[model samples]
Target: MNAESPNIGAPQRPVIRQLSEDAANRIAAGEVVERPASAVKELVENALDAGAQRVDVTYADGGKTLIRVADDGCGMTAADLPLALSRHATSKIDGSDLLNIHSFGFRGEALPSLGAVGRLVISSRAEGFEGAQIAVTGGAIAAVRPAALNRGTVVELRDLFHATPARLKFLRTDRAEAQAIADVMRRLAMAAPYVSFTLRDVSGGEAREIFRTDAEQGELFGALAGRLARVLGRDFADNALPIDAEREGLHLTGFAALPTYSRGAAIEQFLFVNTRPVRDKLLIGALRAAYMDVLSRDRHPAAVLYLACAPELVDVNVHPAKAEVRFRDPALARGLIVSALRHALAGAGHRASTTVAGETLGAMRPEGPRVYQMDRPSGGAIRSAYAWQAPIFAEAPAPFAAAPEPAPEAVNYPLGAARAQLHENWIVAQTADGMVIVDQHAAHERLVYERLKRQMAESGVAAQALLIPEIVELSPADAAR
Candidate 1:
């Protein structure tokens, strides 16, 4: 150590201490409950894990003031209340096996984290046990007391981030936060088609329903289709094609809209891994790759895809919020996504979306009824018209010259035989059942490009030499120059 160093008088030893329970929970809240939407997501997932058939969510002032989630699921008893608020304690999985996680939440930090930053109240009633309620404020827990409740569990959070006032400044406007909450609800609803969901805004003491969907019945695909129609709109359900494909041990199933029904943005894309919604880069990239040849760069494909495999094959603990995941064989998953979507698209042939027909009809509709007036011509006008028809009607126009007719075989061929050329660029051909119009230049260019690509792919565009060389005659002086 140099004597001139300012650290010469500083203590040589450093001390480390454990964080208090309340402080530790508050820190966890910073990760698990970043904002109002985070709280909504955690609570909803818990409800779903409880085997709730229906979930209802209500929020006030973008969840900063209040947020409530109620579900008719198996409620926890009085003894389970305190344990539920303990960090790293969860009923979803055993500590021995972390690889095979089936539930939406397994970290067991959501309840405690919320309690550390806000006033949390949970009221529930089990089937055999009486009703019970527990309250926690700023990481301080109160004793469970008897309360009035029918069945299921109800979690209410009030004054979120009140304990940590500095976090309030990072939140967005009330409307934006509410929109985030709605997005979360939509994703969750799509994942579980059998469950009914409802969302309401309870601001200003007046409750207004923001979204609602009843439980769908029937088989898996049918129920999922009905739920999708209710959530993504009927137009998408009408235009989208059912996708079902399996590779190795992984299976991919869902609906992908036709290329003609693509979106301007990727807002409609939803991906799930074992019923857990995720925004993974590999899956999204593979989806884009599958549609690369059919859609332009500016257009994005719309789809709702679910990839299912053994739970042991994937790791969901990659992120604190469990929004991202890792697969044992990422390449296999990507290939499955790309191949399945491409096959579905190819199976659709050249068919356009049905929604396009509706849009076309709307565009062709008349603005209003049109009126036509008819008047009688006078005798002088009729006489002048007859005078202009003089000269034997111009010798009957030379018997109306006509071109030769095309053969039956030619007409039956695809794209038909060229009947006439218009403006030296368009070909008007007669098909078996209709007339075909082709752009001569554009069609020729595409054909040539495809042929070149095939040739390159087959044998590196095979070199060719001219059999007969052409000679150009020129003056000696010009050739030298």
Candidate 2:
């Protein structure tokens, strides 16, 4: 061996041993408790599963210092409190089967995993039983004791990620975390319209309610529409198209925004499967394809869509966070969404309100024709016009037989009556509500495209290349392929 070269030994043998329950829970917390928002999601899900019609969430320091979720739900008994803080002790499911899961937080990992990383207190009073409470701090279990409560359950978490200080470093600023918490609340609120939700921001000893909504009951769609209007705003409701479609036991319902009322980003799009909000690629792609034709490439349509199907048809356990799912028939899911929404959007034109929005979108283009600029009268009430391509706009054939202008009644087409032709390529017309300016060449292009489509459908399009034939070598090393 060289003088400076030290002796090398074999790698140490790996040890295979089981992890302690506390250690396992802490590991699970790494997956479950990603941030303060994750803790909020897990806690809220538990409350919803408890059959709470009203849920109130309050947090301070973006949930790092304190997070409390109180719900008027069916509370637990004294014996259940300690088990509720233990790992894998759940009342939501029986070990008899896993396929029958309908409840939201069924993994039985949320409470224990949360307890593993933070200080947790759960207090509940089931009907006909005395209220009880249990406290757990960093996987250390506390005795279950009698506690007073009106009804339902109350869970409070403090000093989140205290046991795992590294997680605190991963958390964003208070404002950002607060915004994320608000987003989580919004999604949950949209999912369960029948349930009331109140979210509060209690920072610096000041209590500020950030969001509040009362429970909506009665007809599903009626209540949902009212809730939607409240959450999404009246403008979105005004432009939204309602969709209720079903096929092969897969039901889809909710509202879709018109192409005319599109957005630059997809933040406004909300999707739910069986009342669980998810942002899946399959669902998003289906929606994108649904609006592919009516909406421009750069714009995204806003919507709050819901999907309902049998439990067996979808798997919600694919992710630890349960924010995504795997469908039994992805193609069917995609088809149902795309076809139903497209059909609804196509018919929504009739239900649309008579507004200047359509005219405004059409008038954004440059005023001049491609080749020439007609002298425009300035500072006058510019009449709305529609672009028309009918041959009547053409000049008279005979120099001495110039055609007199058509009667104003003749300009009653959808685009409005044609007014004048500019550069023989553009038409300006007037409509009952607004005016349109048409491009003759663009209209001709569409016409040609439709003609080609029809022809191609009848007899497949034939391909012909214009490249000259040249053969140098059978297998040239410089070949592009």
Candidate 3:
């Protein structure tokens, strides 16, 4: 037994081994650099951390061929260029404090992660210093050298994931990836209205500017509305209600749309913490709850909310990509959003959006001459030519009529008194200023839907078993609230 199998009971040698720097960085890149949009996010965040006032992004072939991000921030010198490419070399924070993170690119993982999977070239120039450049390819470091540049930094990455073809295979179509990149740019632009941003497409032989925003730093929310109008469209501004509310040291400020202006999807909702864009579950749920009463169940309200609080109140290092966040007091943040949004909406009143109002006016103008009717109470009133005389008969005492009912004060009411039901469904209501045309069918449908929802909420939904047993599966980890 000893000669043939080398003794089965013999202890095996330790198989543990340390990974090379390249392999370690590549592994980290898989998490940090998921796609081209991720690369754009990390690089732009680094630029912003450098105090860049203007950032420019150019991409080709959906960033699979080439991607460039240039910023006019304080750049690095020849001595610092090489260190900037080194792993864990960060200027944002020291090793002491993890909770106090003001800048976006705190962890030194993004740069190395990018260099590990792509051909990266960083050219930078510090103030009153010579310009320099450094290159990294597939995690292989190159020597720092002098480069031709006046000021700031420009980072270019070509042939992303070329060394790792499998990563390239997982990328989406060029159009989809390009749209994702645009979304990232727009979100960042909205967050930093003071800083200018430009995006270019250099795919079809020549470079063309896709989107651009100039630096317009002013008072808080200054030019923010203009920027939002440009990004979300002019109609959004016409329909949006300004929100400025604070509670429990958390200040919330942004634009929330009217309930009637709700969209078919929740894509327009944007949430930020201390000017940092995020998509957290607590924030999203609170937004939904705020619009629960005003908006229909099938529709979604659009808004862009920014919250400013102490850095310690929020943990931005929840993930390597830094897209999600963990609030120290999650309940405080949720309550702040719900309270702020509801207050803003209440102040906005029960009015429709500009688009809806215009459409209603246009539709009514095409109809025939407007007909007027007598205002009568709905006390078992029948639709007859003697409809006007029935009210007098109801108040009669003996042979003559008793005291007639006092007329209602129409000025205090919103829709005034209902006059008649024209065309069977349309209710002609007289107002102090003008008459309001209400579609009874549509109004009744919404009322019924809301009533059903209230009943379900109070009693809970009843479940009925199917004739055949059904199968369902759930993940081990709990879903977001």
Candidate 4:
């Protein structure tokens, strides 16, 4: 040891311990559920997975203030209530099985995350047992207690992000949050048409009948169409065309609008896989390819398409939110959408009518008119007519009265002429420098959606002008959020 400076040991380092259950839950929640809408999504999925026939969601102050989701699903027993809020405790999946996920949620993170961040109260009752309630606030759990409730689950969340005030600043206005909540409800409702869904805005006193479907419906399409009519308005149902086709073990089914009914944006394209709503690029590309020939570059079509196949063919776990997916065979999925919609449209007998001078013309006629006639000149025919015509009309004799020439026919310029049908379904068009392989269905869908959006924006949405307005019923707690 030097006398000038006493021998000193290395600086002491603090040992790190594994996060506690409550801390771990808050961390997990940061990834799975962010805002109130995320909480709503997880709860709604849980309800659906629990075999709920009807679900009701209510919100206030853009979900920053409050959110509640009640489901008439298989209610939880008293024993299950405590386990429901425990981290990593989920009825959806087993820890051994991470590869195959059939349900919308399986991480077992939602309940814990929600409880960690907000004032969470979960009340439920199975058929045999009395109702039980559990409350958790800021990662602190209160003991479970007996409660009175119907045979269902009601989850109430209040003061979202109160424990984490930093997240509170990220929320939007109440109206915007309400709109986002409505959008989520619409997507979920579209996915599960057989389930009744109701959404209420407690802050504004605005109640929307989001969805109502009879479980006895023969097939999903009918119920889905009814639900879409409720969310997207009845005009969409009338304008949409049915789509059903199969390729490479994948089945595509849904409805797409005609090119004439396009919208100004791609917002109307509702895509689902195995009854789970998603926004896959391949599917959107395929839809675009379907209407490439009939629509302009600026427009999009309106469509609601469902794809079904083996779960292994598509990976739904690509995102935490699961709004997007990855396909084992991207080309095959794109091809299926393009071919299905193209074939369906063709079979429906919808031919693009020619437009000229603001008027739609019927199909072309080979012998309709002779704009230029070619004939062998008779004896003195050409010379004599030309020789006499110039002298008689020296100053053009006041322009000749002739019908205006018909406007040029609009031609289908294959995007790049690199038009190759991939997988016997998709039409790949080459661009000027880059290649633009389109999904015929998604392209047409974009076009149709664009036109409709433009028309709506200019003249306001064409409401059905209801003879008798449909009245919506709501629950008291739901009404109060």
Candidate 5:
């Protein structure tokens, strides 16, 4: 050993001792409860896993001082309260098979981890059982006692990260964290369209509703559409195309937006694996690949896609928070998404998204002030002026008097008939509801490109044999390269 070594006289043998249960739980909290949003995600997911029909979440000061989640879900019994706060205790799965997980939680770490870091209270009343409540502060459990409740469970967590104040330093601003919480709720709501969700913010003794969606009714797609309309807005619901496709054992279902309705950032893309929301790179890559041709590189396609398969085919235990998964056949899943979205987009044909018309109308709105119907000429006065011009129309030249070419018969076509051209580039067409202004060069380029692609698809690649075959012999090692 060097004489100047810092550990020259230190003990040769190290002593190892088991960490206290409370200390161990705090360590686990470091992994499970990173921020307010993470805590919200775990609690909400637990509620959903417990067969919740409706979930209500409220937070204060970005969940630093207060956070509460009440769910109309199957409640736990008094005997289960203490166990639920123990490490590695969960009702979501058996210890036998990890690959076949169907719920959002399995490791049984979220509740205990949360209790270790916050002042946690769970009150509940199960069917055929009396109401009970349990409280834990900084990993110190209190005796279970009778409490008042209704049909489900209410979990209240106050002063989160109170035990480990160091973790609080990593939190973002209150507004940003609240937005993150809302984002989590939105993803879960989208995942389970049939379940209702309400999120509220309670700060400074005032309760403000942030987001709410009632349970949707009807078939899967219909319910999903209604839920989407409520959650993602009517614009998305109207512009999105329905996607239903299957390959091998995987079934893909969701709505994908039209290329014309794409966004500048990848904000609205939501992917789920067997009803569990996931942020997987493989699925995102597949979505981008599907729309690579229709959308520019700077634009991102918006979609909400769900991939369903046998539970055993995908492993959901890949991450601590269950945000990622491992697919038994990643290629198969990727190919299914890519093919389904591409097929849907291809089948949309020449249809323009409603967002385009909305944007056009918005842009055409006048900025000037004060114009009312009463300020304009009366309808009878306009009719009388038209009657005065009738004889002038009758005295017009023969070319002008030939019924004006029947107004170009604007009937079936959405673009109606090409009425005029301007600057040798813009083509103006009349439609039933309104007029369409198109860039002639851009439209022509797109039409030509589509035609070329169609021809290529029809004729296949022209194949011809090489005039002369030139080959070189290689050694065994070089041939492998």
Candidate 6:
């Protein structure tokens, strides 16, 4: 009868084992370098962090077959080569300090992960040492040997996804991949206008002068505009409005297109943070909302908005690709975008343009004048001989008099030079068909809605609260839905 004698035992737990260095590196590489473009991004970031003034990216067959990034920055010494490939190894930050990251790339797994998945060769030379070469294939390291090279690093990757053919199958076409690579390069070029970039396609023998900036000038906006004009097209420069605003310790600066100058696609909306290009849904949503009143729903605005703030306020490690980010105060970020863009558009006197086409038929007569008659009082007395010429008829002549005045031939007035804009919102005009009524506000609403839906489908929506409370009294069922 002893209820306290029940058996008690500790539950067994499964033991976890750390993966081997090679396996770990490969796993990390899977996250960092999902495709050849990702590898290119990581290597370029390293070169930029090394203070490289010029970066050259060459690739073949959409970078699946080969990719090489060469930079004219301070190259790694012979001793640093091995350390650079090791996991969790980086010269940028010391241990116990993960909050403040000044370099574009501080994670040291990029090179090794790439090496694990494919063939990787790194050649470099420091200021006062002979050039050195290090090679790795399928996570196997080769001996470092002396080689002839310049005063920088050249990282080459070949036969990507050869060890993992499954990953290769997910890749897009060669042209599409090449375009993605170019897009990545263009964004980076926009972020760092002081750096020079060159991209070449070895397979098609095509080359592009992606970016070139004058170091002495040191004008980020001008250089960005020039580069954007070169890469995106010249029309963007003509239609874009400059953005400069600050709020809640965050500074927003860049160019946004006028409502009249929107695009059918959002491929031109480039966003950057602390000189690094990113694609965050909240930011994109805020951008769409800012232009909602001006742009049509099916269209997207051309913009390049740079957001600068303390690193602690934003977390860039939310995604392995570093494309998306989480902000400590997302509302502040959204407000910055909406207010900055709204101010810029208003200052630019943004307006929608419209056109109409039609062919004239023939002349037509104007309608006869409308007439009204009143009932006469009961007859009082007979008066003069001109009784028929009463007061009403005294000021007008008979319609059938004088043989109908030769039946005056019909005439036309050519709809008289379409009326000008009424109150800046409505446009009044006359046509042979009928009068036309246009609601500027409603038209713009439709436009913005379509655009927002499209953007949400492509990149997701960014929601922000109104600065002022937006109160509404709705029925219970409707509110719940």
Output the number of the TM-score-best candidate: 5
Clash totals in order: 0, 10, 0, 37, 0, 6
Summarize candidate 5's per-residue lDDT along 273-390 as a digit string, tens digits.
9999999999999999999998889989999999999999998888787888889999999999999999998888645566454333333233457788778889896986677678
TM-score of each: 0.76, 0.74, 0.76, 0.70, 0.78, 0.72
Q: Candidates ranked by lDDT, best first?
A: 1, 5, 3, 2, 6, 4
- Candidate 4 — which residues are off by over 4 angstroms? 1-16, 204-216, 349-481
Q: Which stretches in model 6 have alpha-carbon errors above 4 Å? A: 1-15, 204-218, 352-481
Q: Pick the candidate with the highest lDDT.
A: 1
Each prediction's whole-model lDDT (CA): 0.86, 0.81, 0.82, 0.76, 0.85, 0.77
TM-score of 5: 0.78
In model 1, the Cα lDDT at residue 438 comes to 68
**Alpha-carbon shift of residue 3 in model 4 (angstroms):** 32
Ten-residue region with minimum lDDT total, candidate 4: 356-365
Task: State model 6's lDDT.
Answer: 0.77
> Candidate 1 lDDT, tens digit per residue, 7-38?
55775786899999999999999999989999
Per-residue lDDT tens digits for candidate 2, residues 29-138, read 99888888898998888989989999999999988999999999999999888888777778888867665678887788999999999999999999999999999999
Clashes of 6: 6
- Candidate 1 residue spans exceeding 4 A from truth: 1-12, 361-481
lDDT of 3 by residue, 149-179 (tens): 8689999999999878899889999878888
